[model samples]
Each structure stands twice: as structure tokens, then as C-alpha cells.
Target: MDGKRFQNYEAYFTILDTGEKPITQEWLVSLIENHENNLQYAPDVWREYIKK
Candidate 1:
């Protein structure tokens, strides 16, 4: 994964686990829509994690 993706992953996991200023579903949806292609190329771990 790229450094930017790793950083996003770190930030997402941190917010997910700590429940501190968690991301909103709307924002998440927007991100997905904006990065659909990038996400398709992302690791399986990310795909499965998002499915949860």
C-alpha cells in the first residue's frame, strides 16, 4: 500500500478502536464514492474490514 493509504488506514483504525471523533457514515460514503477505483486496488484486509 502507499504511504497515504497507510496513513488513512492508521487514522481509520485509531478512530474505530478509540471511538474518538469517529467518522460519520456520510463522510465514509463520500470517501468511497470519491476513491472507488483506488479502493478496488486496495488490500483485501481493507475490503473485508470495510464490509464489517
Candidate 2:
């Protein structure tokens, strides 16, 4: 992973614990590519992410 995506992964993992569904690398890539900025403050919108 590049620096930005790696940062995102770290930020995401820092904020949320793993749920019933795993947060796999593929999903994180989709999220980073599609909605990178949206998740900077993920605590407010983590549920929306899980659905995607």
C-alpha cells in the first residue's frame, strides 16, 4: 500500500474495532479509492462504511 492508503488503514483501525464482518484489504481499497476523504473522521460515519 502507498502512503495515503496506509494512513487511511491505520486511521480506520485506530477508530473502529473489527465487527462481525471483517474489514479486509479489498474493502479498504474500495473505500480509499472511492471515498478517501469521507472517512478521515470515521467515528461519525462508520456505520455507513460497514454497509458499503
Candidate 3:
């Protein structure tokens, strides 16, 4: 993993114990990276990121 995603994963295990807070950018980015690494990055994707 790249440094940014690696840091995010680290924080996920250690610091981000409670997922009650609003999602961090690192987490969001990591999710996208996991789902679709081939896609181009775009800030607009965040507009509908958390729909359940």
C-alpha cells in the first residue's frame, strides 16, 4: 500500500477505535482505493459516498 493508505490503515486499527465520529478523509479514500484502484480520482465522488 502507498504511504497515505498505509497510514489510514494504521489509524484504523489504533486511533480510530470508535467509528462514531464522522468518517475521516483517509478512511474514505482507502475505501475507494480498495474498491476500484483503476478508476481516476475525483473529489466529486465524495458527494454521494455514504449512501446506505
Most lDDT-accurate candidate: 2
What is candidate 1's lDDT per residue for 1-52, written digit by digit as tens? 4545433333333323423444446545656676655564444555567788
TM-score of each: 0.32, 0.30, 0.25
| lDDT against the true structure, each candidate | 0.51, 0.55, 0.44
Minimal lDDT window, size 10, model 3: 38-47
What is the per-residue lDDT of model 3 for residues 1-52, given as tens digits with 9 covering 90 to 100?
4545533343343233333446456556856676564223423334345332
Error of 1 at 13 (Å): 4.5
RMSD of 1: 14.8
lDDT of 2: 0.55
Error of 3 at 21 (Å): 1.1
Worst 10 residues of 2 by lDDT: 5-14
**Clashes per model (N, Cα, C within 3 A):** 0, 0, 0
